[model samples]
Target chain A: MRVLGVDPGLTRCGVGVVEGVAGRPLTMLGVGVVRTPADADIGHRLVAIERGLEEWLDTHRPELVAVERVFSQHNVRTVMGTAQASAVAMLCAARRGIPVALHTPSEVKAAVTGSGRADKAQVGAMVTRLLRLAAPPRPADAADALALAICHIWRAPAQNRLQRAVAAQHAQNAPKGRTA
Target chain B: MRVLGVDPGLTRCGVGVVEGVAGRPLTMLGVGVVRTPADADIGHRLVAIERGLEEWLDTHRPELVAVERVFSQHNVRTVMGTAQASAVAMLCAARRGIPVALHTPSEVKAAVTGSGRADKAQVGAMVTRLLRLAAPPRPADAADALALAICHIWRAPAQNRLQRAVAAQHAQNAPKGRTA
Candidate 1:
């Protein structure tokens, strides 16, 4: 499956697309950052991010989109900007009927570097080796985006299977067409 | 100016439109809530919100759109959802080229009830009195939405003048071919 991962931010949003399946080496379809001026109004910045995401969606056409799940931060302003940018990414995928998944930073780190506590450098190194690239992607956010895509690509299958099994069990226990 | 106020939330988003100038009596053009099931997927929920806000914008065609500024909350998940919904509201207004404003909760309370620390009931009462309605609007979120519209209507004139004064001062100090 081809997956697009987004590391959402107001000033600089990282975007990367990877094509791969279980037990297969992934191919880098594209990677880049979408930037908006810091001095611009919040609404205008959001619009710019939306336009950038739409362009990427049109050009790459990834099957799935993975976005970083926003968590609380000490800096309320920074967190708000990140959350806003993250929403735009999800909305872009939804508008196109593309499935979107959210992965926490820790989950991405664990998936890519075998540790939830892995630092940015470790995650970047692992991503480089996994993608067989000559060097790690620059601008930490770009590498982080690739890690998110790899995490979702590796985790989604197992997650989907688990969901289906739970749904089947619930269906068997339900009475008539109603869920208990 | 006509203003549409949005109180963004994941499960229940309140939307209201009011028409008036700073010193004139405001007319309530419309007021309602957009609700999504808690069990729905996040992407679907966001799309539902985007569609709902877009419909409101198209129908009301307000000159200004006012959204409640999301603040950091102790609950990370709740804050994330609110921030996401708030972004969608801004995006809708920006897409239509409608000027958008964000009012903090305290600012809305202060403008409507004369106190930033006023409770929800007090704000509701003030909104009801300001709109000359027999009763307060149902659901606190709906009343808060109206309060936001009122706050923006009352504050925007002063804010605009201040901005223009700053621009004028900068223009006078700038070089012939550039702005400071």
Candidate 2:
């Protein structure tokens, strides 16, 4: 499956497309950053990011979209922008009927580098090796996006199985006469 | 001018429309809440909000949209959801070319009740009195939404004048060879 990963931010949103399946080699389809000026109005910046994401969705046509799950930060302003950007990504995917997944930073690091505490350099090096690229993608965010996609590709199967198991257990435990 | 005020929340988004000019009696065009189930998927919840906001925009056709500016809250999850909802409200307004304004909760309270520290009851009472309603709107969020509209109606004139003055000063200071 192909996945478009988004490292959401207001000033610079990183996007990368990866095509692969579990237990198989992966290929990088595209990678870029959508940059909006810091001085731009918040609404306009969001609109720009929306348009950029739409373009990526249109051109890449990934089967699923992976977005970084925003966690609380000491910098409220930064966290707010990240959350807004992440919402835009989710909205874009929903509008297109494309499935979207969110991966935490630690989850992504663990998936890509086998260490939740992996440093940026280690994660970048692992991503480079995994994708067979000559060098790591620049601007840290781009590499992070790729890592997110890789994480989702590797984890989705296990997650889906767990979801199904829970659903089956719920069905078995429900009263026989329940309509739901 | 008509204004649509949005008190954005993930579980229950409060929306209200008011029509009036500065220094005049305002009319309440509409008031309601758009609610999404807490158990729904995040993407689906966002899409539901988008649809609800779009419907309000289409039905009310407000000239401006006033959204409560999301601030950092002690509850990170609540703040993130509020920020996301606020972004969706802004997106709806921007998509329709409607001017969007953000009012802080304190700003709304101050505009309506002459005290930024006013309690919800005070703000609701003022909204009822200002709109000539027999009673305050139910659900504090709905009342807050109306308060936001009233705040924008009252502040727009001074804000416009300040914007124009700033623009004029910039124009006057521009280089002679520059054309703007």
Tens digits of per-residue lDDT for model 1, B88-112: 8887776555667888999999999
Point out the worst 10-residue segment of candidate 1 chain A by lDDT.
A171-180
**In terms of docking quality, how is candidate 2 classified?**
acceptable
Model 1, stretches more than 4 Å misplaced? A160-180, B160-180
Question: In TM-score terms, which candidate is top?
Answer: 1
Our tally of clashes for model 1 stands at 0
- Taking the tens digit of each residue's C-alpha lDDT, what string does model 1 give over A4-78? 999999999999998888689988888899999999778767888888898898899887789999888668999
- Best-fitting candidate, measured by DockQ? 1
Please provide TM-scores, in order, for all candidate models, with all chains considered together: 0.88, 0.88
- Output the worst ten-in-a-row residue range by lDDT, candidate 1 chain B: B171-180
TM-score of chain B of 2: 0.87
Off by over 4 Å in 2: A160-180, B160-180
- Candidate 2, residues B24-103, lDDT tens digits: the string is 89999999898989996676678778888888988998877899999886688899899999988887676545667899
